[model samples]
Target: MEQLKQALTSAPVLILPDPERNYVIEADASDQAVGAVLMQDQGNGLQPIAYLSKKLHGAELNYPIHDKEALAIIIAFKTWRCYLEGRKTTVYTDHCSLKYLKTQPSLSRWQVRWIDFLETHFHYDIVYKPGHKNKADALSRPAHVAAIQIEGMNPLLKGLFTHGYTIDPEIPLAEKRHLLQWDNDIAYRKGSMKIWVPNYPPLRQLLLEEYHDVLYAGHFGSNKTLTGIAKHYFWPHLAKDVQKFVTSCDTCQRMKSSKQKKAGLLQPLPVPEQPWQVVSLDFITGLPPTTSGHDAILVVIDKFSKMGHFIPTHTTAHTEETAQLFVR
Candidate 1:
């Protein structure tokens, strides 16, 4: 083991990637470090082109195992961008979740940003391999260590217990039991805190108030509100419930309106068959008050003849009175 460790740490020769040839990347991450190897397909076997490994620090140190694994891929791609950007590259990772990285739900802010970066910057396919088969796994850890020691329990549990949640039925039985505990009549997921939610209205309202009315929430729109609440809570049809709640918010209705759509195309009223047969009427309000109390103009238009009639009237004129003047 000591000899192997010495050999792995020893400097070695690296091949230059051929632009016209295909490339492959093997990436892996340990609790403290991320490592990857860039390889070119030589007709006989895979030739190592480059090796990368870095210790995790700061916010990156807090990332969950899957994210660390993903970080390894991102780092590898960035380091070898010159060779992999234009050509087809296949990325191999021991973490299976990375295969569906872009489609995973309830992504953290960093995860979303990482996914965006990966999508925009790389043209590649991710392939999943067993930990034992991944070549880069050794580079990320000491050769003496036969297995990677996970840093902590519930690394992915932050914000997961902030709200009430139920174990999804789709979860496998073993995982369901592992993630949830039944106490009294309510079920809870164990993490830094217990996550249990009563299906009652009060709890739902409290969650809505915190997520939709809080200062940090900023009265975000329904989709954003749903995402914010979902980071820590789960319920059946939770998004639909959030949609309904946000849609019914009086504050949102009074202070905000959607600008995503424009008014539909103008439909001009059908041309009238004859002058005065079809008319359009409107009142020009807020004119200067005249001494005779005539401070508004009622304009009537004959749609067929393209002609108009203007009459002066009081701004407070009643509908009945206005109709009588038009009759006269």
Candidate 2:
């Protein structure tokens, strides 16, 4: 054993349980200094499952207090679900903050939903270990092995599910053209002109089944329609529809106010021939008391040279005081 250890000390050694299961992970600076191990119970004996020497990005970072934590919880729950995909298992982490899984008092609405998801899915145990001992499992494997990017599911589907498809061919050609035109206009405006949909059949089906109500809602404005389409569809596609719908809305035209003409058409004022020869004056008010107990500023601008003086004053400054300030 001593000879083998010396021979293998310089090589990357991987420890595994019985030969069937393989786990891959890497450690960051934080976890490298504090090694971790994993132990699995094999009925007759305790097996050394994995060893990690580094930190995983998500677990060790100081994530934000609200939405980020909720995201972390969802990530953790998903990881746990994958770990126990087809069987019951025990999970452990050193993050004691997660101990309040069931009854977290200050969790936001989203976090509560995540907790409910954890409760509904797999049955498992979450044990918190001290940071020093957490190295056994925490350091044994990299943190990202737990990350599974499950895309295309409805955001509300808080559990694992498969993607399903449907088709619709009855949408009118005129409506399709209108949608295409709007898509193109928006794509051009947003500098995403490269986007294309080879066949509109699947999109037609998706819109008809999932987005028909929102699209047909009363005189869909750009912001409202964009928000509606984006909820169920990807942004680029929705941007096109939003651009088209907004451009075609009759009610928007009738109610929209005409934009004011540009002000730059007027000639600029002549430059001051002499500094302090002519002056524009105005009073600034409603300020908090300054160190000098003043709450206003009398602004005097020289009309010729465009220079100005700001004199601070109390609210009670009389006409005589104002005259004195201007002279000063």
Candidate 3:
């Protein structure tokens, strides 16, 4: 009974591939390597059946992320042909562009070749899963992993940035256009190292999300999130956008620690040793005018003895008058 309980507590483990069950492959690619895990759901949730990893070399190392991701899927299908040939297979990738590989209008000679192999051999659907959600991310990195670079820009972000640069009225302003520098497809200010971001809501939102919402970015508050993002990327009202996104974040709202100071716990005051040893004094004003024109009462109390004195005084009494009354 104890052994059965322990086994149930842990997650499902590797299992033999079931020919009847459809296969799920979660694949990811780093700059120099690609990795994929072959899984099958046999009654229990998705369990690993096999894992594949390959190191990129020469020109392969330089292949853009799209090709590398496609290669990862192709290799997985080739390795698991026996189990996945006739069975309907699903490929999950962090690169969103791979989902539309078949319909992409322009393709390089090598990309077409890679696509040809997969199309002829495999019957599968490619789905987009965020990089943080993909399971094979760890297996895809080289021996020395990067510190904090996100996998790659999402397809939506890339498209938005491209279109934004063209239509952004601010970017073409005389002061900025004269200072802008071009590196490949990216635009930068002549003297600044930060990547210039155009005025695009979707692109800005995605950037804000990637820097603040992702696990590595640590759902930080507006100020810190803005600071981290500003280090490498620049746009108008960047801080304002970060503040808005952070304020609206569902996780931040629910999980953020309260900033209010907690009230101090009540503790009993120390007892006085003798009468008049400690005393408190105050004046209560705003009373109705009295017969003698006195409208306030001076209150004095002794700590040790449960005794108080109420002295009549005018609301406008001077400091000297109050002191004389205290002496009296």
Candidate 4:
């Protein structure tokens, strides 16, 4: 149990699956339970997308090793059907008998049913792997239980339910009506977190700090940070707040560079119809003083005629003087 906890928390072993990448399923079965690990190859190596496990009950406990392993694959496929259904998947098991499972001349009723289900529902390649090489082996055993912390209700929500008003006055009124509801003294949403985040400055700032500056948070970009926070909390304009917080974050400003592409293409200016009507003026300064006591020249160009005018002037001429000179 301790080892499982350590393994789970040591680093990020699981990641969101990408549809463009191929998937691998590693399944194993113990006498008591069956477990499977879903993984994807992202060029770096195999990264886990999810892990599933369930205890054996009823007739499942009496199944032999071959049936148990095959059952693990079936259960795993059904559990992750959304991701596995249309993709090319490879199923790995320690049982070598499964390598040619379809070729077996004789089959039990359960085996026949399982084979039919596998052939009909999924497109997969079954491969035999040694137990020691299977990463999901520990999950199949009884010792695979790991300590996990569930984010309980947000602190601000408790205050609202108990006192009928939250401490934070800044939290919008519409959010309470639109986003939240209570049942059995516990908050529930259509598909949101049990935790509620009040728009109070202190609590909101604290939440941002925990997710942005904390060691585990890794100071990721605003979108990822908002996604992570949304999994466990909710507030009105939460995404707007996340963007504001990330934009103002000092560490992010200093360490990270912008990856966004520049907006809009350059458009050329329209050509002029006549000379002097669309003239451009520029000062050429820092020249050697001339006999006329002028150290700069104003060069004006006519757009249509390409005509040029050179006007001598003092380098330090004020705006009004320059304007008068242009008019003259």
Q: Tell me the deviation in Å of residue 147 in model 2.
A: 27
Better of 2 and 4 by TM-score: 4
Ranking by lDDT: 3, 4, 1, 2
For all predicted structures, in order, the TM-scores are: 0.43, 0.30, 0.44, 0.42
TM-score attained by model 3: 0.44
| lDDT, model 3, position 135 | 82
The C-alpha stretches of model 3 lying farther than 4 A from their native spots are 1-12, 142-328
Candidate with best TM-score: 3
Per-residue lDDT for 1-328 in model 1, tens only?
8986565545353566789988999999876688998888767578788889899899886676678888898889878887787788899987666888888778988788877887887778998875557789887854423311222313333223232234333334424568655544335444311234445566667677777886656787787676545433455578888899988988998999776777889897677787799888899999998898889999998888879899999888998989987887
- Candidate 2: tens digits of C-alpha lDDT, residues 40-139: 4545444444443433365433333223323433454464345434444454544444555676568656667877776777555655543233334333
Tell me the spans in candidate 4 whose CA falls farther than 4 Å from its real position.
Answer: 1-11, 142-328
Ranking by TM-score: 3, 1, 4, 2
Model 2 misplaced stretches (Cα beyond 4 Å): 1-39, 42-88, 105-109, 136-322, 325-328
The pairs that clash in candidate 4 are: 154-195
* TM-score for candidate 2: 0.30
lDDT of 4 by residue, 191-217 (tens): 332345554566667677777777766
Evaluate residue 271 in candidate 1 and report its C-alpha lDDT on the 0 to 100 scale: 75
How big is the positional error of residue 324 in model 1, measured in Å on the Cα after superposition? 97
Steric collisions counted per model: 0, 18, 0, 1
Instruction: Give the per-residue Cα lDDT of candidate 1 at 209.
Output: 76
User: Could you tell which candidate, 1 or 3, scores higher by TM-score?
Assistant: 3
Residue 233 lDDT in model 4?
A: 57
lDDT per residue for candidate 3 within 27-109, as digits (tens), equals 98876688999998898788888888899899886676568788888788888888888778999987767888889899989
